[model samples]
Every structure is written in structure tokens, then in C-alpha cells.
Target: MPLDLSRRSLFTGAAGLTVSGLAGAGLAGCSQTAPSGTTDAAFPPGAIDPHLLGPAEGVALLSRNENPYGPSQSALDMIEYAASKGAYYANQEAAVSLMSMIAEKNGVDPEQVVLTTGSGEVLSAIAVLYGPRGPIVAPRLFWDTTALYAANLGMAEIQRVPLTDEMEIDLAAIEAAVTPDTGLVQLCNPNNPTGLVSDPATFQAAVRRMAATTTVLVDEAYIELSDDPEANSCVPLISEGHDVIVTRTFSKIYGMAGIRLGYAIASAETAAAIRPVVMSWSPCTSYAAGIGCYNDDAFIDFSKSKVTEARDMVFATLDTLGLDYLPSQTNFVYFKSGLEANAVQAAMAERLISVRGQYMDYNEWTRVSMGKVEDVERFCRALPELIEA
Candidate 1:
């Protein structure tokens, strides 16, 4: 259901990019955190896979940053209909339609977009196109999955720059690090592990500066959950004809991790460079569900409200327990565990809670994904016991 241009024209103010929020919510490939409710004996249509853990009750999986509320009713109904019809394979036309809407929202030509299994696949494709003994520049302590992808492909070295003391990405440092031989530069706005963002104007200037020497990858997997996803995004950079690629997912905000769908926006030339290398496909069911959710402002608003409630609960508990934490722009928060993070992790695991640790260089830093308010409360109840021991 591609929205008519007349209807699309209605999106102009705060809701301009809100229509596309359902498109790029994000997912970490493995279920480091299972779907919010781990107890039901019966698996739901898009239930969390048992990839990392067996199903059970009262398990709070705050490690994955997944949407606990799940896909909108409209999306769910579409998914159910697709599955009922046994559309086991993906449809090319469906992908075309989905990308058409995404392109319109980003103000780019449809040819400038490409679909991936998840945003993670787009990262891998970028690495595959430009790695295996190339200079990729990135933050020293940010998201590592893409770095790990390059490493596995034998990327010789990634020139790393440290973030500023205030926890924002050091755009100048990154620009300075770019060399004539640099293949790609990565900027994870509202960075992972730190949950902090850089100034958008400064970010765009850096992208323009670095684009001269190398391809820039702006991973905005968590951008939709930001206070103003539109202003913070890099799609505008793409619209202005920069060699930048912005990848996002439906796993986080849209609650479709199990369905596995995401896409990338780039200049037509950059898209052309990466298109042939990607599968050029998304599951038919995923496309249908995405269409159903694309403009569902009610569900998006409700989900954001839920995240706010849960995030506040987490912040309040962190303060009560005398923990120092970074202010967040997304659904999760990063805090100092004080004790051995692994020990805290194991302790919580025993209590049926899963969290994330082992970020770049901090032993005390822990990343906790926002769950339902009650789930965060359970984690808070378990925190004191976990850290004290």
C-alpha cells in the first residue's frame, strides 16, 4: 500500500520523517536479548528465536534493545495473512514497493535504495566491497559488529579515533584520520555503548569533508528512538549527493526482529555500487507488515510512550542505587556496573535477566536495553543483589 502522493503530502512538520520510523528500527543478528516476554509456553507469530536461550518465564532480556510491545495490530494482521497464504519466498515487486515508500520519505530516487536481510547485512556488504586489507576509520569504542565483519574478512587495519571526553563522537578527529587510502569511514550517531550523539550539522560537515577521501557509513540503527529522528538522520546528506550510506532496521522500534527486514539509503552512485552485491530482496511477509506499519502514527506514538516510561524507570533506579550512567537518546541506557561486569551479568542471568557488557574498553560499562516498565522494575530489584555480591 504505497501511500498516494496526495496523502503523502500530508507529512510535512514533526511527522515528516515519522512516516518512515517503522522502516529502520534495527536488530543485533543474534538474540542477545530474547523478545520481552520469555515465559509463554506457546510461540507467537513473530516470537523470539531460541537461538541463545531456551524459553522460560520471568526472564527479562534487556540486552537486545528490542521493542517489547511488538508490531502494530495492522502489521501483525498483514504478517498473519501472508503466512496463511504460504508465501514462503520473497516477492521482488513487494520489495520494490517497500523501497518506493522509503525513497519517497528520504527524498531520494528509488534507485538509491537497496534492501538487506537486516541492516546488519548492509554493513557486511559494505565491508565485503571495501575490506580485506583496507583502511576503515571509526571510533575506538563504539559498535563493533561491522568492525568484526571487516576483521573476519581480513581487513588489515582500521584507523581508530577516540571519542570526545563528553562521550560525543569526535567528528574532527575522524576527519583528521581520513587518508587518501581510507576506504570507508563509519559514524554511529547516538553511538552504541555510550548512547550519546554528535551535533547533526557538525556531523553533516564531517561527512562532506570525509566523503572526498572515502565512503562514509552512517549507522542510524537507533536514530528513530531519538528525541527527533528526522533532524538527527543523515538521509539529507544522501539527498545532497554524498557518497554516504545510511543503514537501518525494523527490529527495534517496529518489533519485527524475527521477521528480519531493513534497508539502506545512499546516493544513486553509492547505491549502484552496493546494489549488485546485495540480495536485492526482502521477504514478502515482511514487506506487507512494513506497509501496514509505515504510517501507523498511533502505534508508533504508543511504542515511544512505552519506551519513555520504561526508560524513566531505569534512570530512576540507576539514581537510587547511586550508579553513574550516560544520558541516552535511544531506548537503552549505559551505566557503570562498578563490580566486574561479567560477574554482574552472570548474577543477573541466574536471576533470569540478560544484559549486555564487554563494550570496547570499559570493564564497568554495561548496556541495558529498555524493556517494559515492569521488566525494568524486575531488573532493578535484582541489580542491588547482583552488584553487591
Candidate 2:
């Protein structure tokens, strides 16, 4: 199917789900404690290379793991409308509405959901709220946010586990690494830079084991983009009364990273503990846009389908090149280039294309986000010359 690039008008009266049934379901169980840190004091300016993407007219922008089709027409219109209200600040009403919607959809209580600007805020919060308590354990090639923030807070204990031969986390090895001082264990499902997913049952079992030792944070930023996303999420662990936090985002599948709307799920008490540490707001427009994005199921299905198609084509290309790659369950592929990462990145840059230089313990790897069909075609064409020369 050809992409629907045109804007779709949103129903003015129904920008989001009706507020009729949502009145008494307010999710204010989170403590109103003022977040402990300020931006200047909490986030050190030069913490880590933020790895910001450089998008241009002709650039493929395969570097950052972001959705290419972007939010649906309905979401865009909703954002604009919400912003035009000229509300000077982020709206808690929108957050309340979002929590209600999420709770109802997932069969969880509204108070258990913590809305943040994006999962990144919750990640940083975990560092402050939990990281200072003990050492952090994580996969070396996974999302680097927690490690970076933990360092920014001047806390030095972090253990990076090496991925297996197949680029998957060995749950047993991770369990073995947890010591008495282990404060938190972080996992990014359908992990970035590799895009491999863990079995939910195995993940829950690992959390059950780890919960006895320390808190667990499951960063599901890409879960909705995974195969059988419902089973890939760890939110259910919260219901089982585990000290597990599942952070999610509308950024990947919903194509709304710019909107800055995401959430974290934990026991209501745990959520209250993490909530006070967050400093950013999930803006009024973001909240409104999130609602619109959530309602636009058509766009979500379409984007997922397109991503699968593009991902398969890239895998086929890598096979033709006889290159080995981590079999992906998400929108990207991590492949062996048989060349130095920096050189390949520089070459791709010259072609007005951007990809990542993901260095793993065993090999030099490159990961490319599945982009639009045309962008992927440009990437496939340019990949050979860059890898060879």
C-alpha cells in the first residue's frame, strides 16, 4: 500500500476519548512531593554525547531510532488545537486523561501509571531515585541513558554485561551479576542498536529473581514496535506486585518523539517514589497529541506494517552481502560491516546519509533504523560503496 502522506482532519468535538466515563478515575495517587533536583544541578551539561541526529532534506536519518511516517494527521491537528488554547504551561488534565485511557486499555489501575515527557525522564529519574542506592547492571550495548545519568550524579558503580553470540542478554548471567549492592537492573526490550527482543516470560522470571535483590527497570521504548508487543511488555509484573518498572514511549511506533509523550508503569507506591524525581513536563500539546495518536489506530497499524516490510528488505540486502546480523523483532537491524565503524559512518555521512557506530565487545557493529522505503533504498545503494571503499 502506498503511504498516506496527506493530513487527516480530526473531529473537533472528539479530539480524545469522551470525558464522560473518566470523571472519578483520577490518578493522583503519585505523591506531589517536589522533584528533588533542578536541571542545572541534576543534568550536567556535558554529561555524555547525546547522540543527536542530523536530519536534512536528502539525509536518510537512519542514525536515530525514530519513526519516519510521523504522527497521523489527527495527532498533528490535535496538537495544534491544544497549543492554540495558549495555555502557558503543560496541562495536568491531559495527563489525567492519558492515564485514564492507558489504565482502561491495559487493565491496570490509573494510579499505577506515571506520565512523563518521555521514557527518558523516567530513566533519568531511576538514576536519582534508585541509582544512588547501589550499583547499576545493564547490557553494555543497550540504551546508555541510565549509565550516563548515574555518572552525572557522581555515582561510580555500574556493571555492563556482555551480550551473547546471538546478541541477546543471557538472563542467567545477568542474575549472577547482581550483588548485595546492586541498586537497579535496566533492560531495553527490542533493545536499541541491536533491536533484539526478549521473551516476556523469561523477562518476568528474571524480574521475579532480581526483585528480591533490588529494583528492576524495563525500558520498553520500542515494545509497541516489536512482534507481539502485548507479550513483550513487563507491565504485568506490576500487577503481580513486583518492584518492576516498565517505561514506554509513543516515540517509536506512534512517530511522536517530537511530541514528548511517554509513560512508566509500576506499583502505585513505586510510581509515587519515581514521580517526584522527574523534572520535565509532558506538555499540553503533547498530552493532547498523545490522545490523538492513541485514537489513530489506523496510522499505528500502517506504520508497523511499513516498518516490517522495510526491515525485511534490509535483511535481504544484508543476506545478499553475506553479512551477519542480529535477527530483529523491531524496526532496525544490526549487521556486521567487516569495516571500521568510524570510517563507515564518515562515508555514509558524505553520502548525506546517517547511521550509527555501535561498537560491541566482540565486534564492530553498525545499526540502521528502518526508514521510509525510499530512504532505505538510498541506504541499500550507498551501503555497498561505503563498506567497500
Instruction: In candidate 2, list every pair of residues with a backbone clash.
Output: none
The prediction achieving the highest TM-score against the true structure is 1
lDDT of 2 by residue, 7-74 (tens): 12100111222333123212111222444543555556757223322255677888767788987888
Clashing pairs in 1: 24-249, 25-249, 26-249
lDDT of each: 0.75, 0.75
- In model 2, state the lDDT of residue 16: 29
Candidate 1 lDDT, 1-389, residue by residue in tens = 23223311211122222322222322353534346655665557777555434224678888888887878898899888877756466555666677788888888877777777777767766765766536778988777676665565465357789888877788888898888888789878778878887778888888988987788899898888888899999889877777788988887788777777778888766766665545335567788888778778788788888888888888888898899998898888989978777777777888888888666567887888887768788998888776666
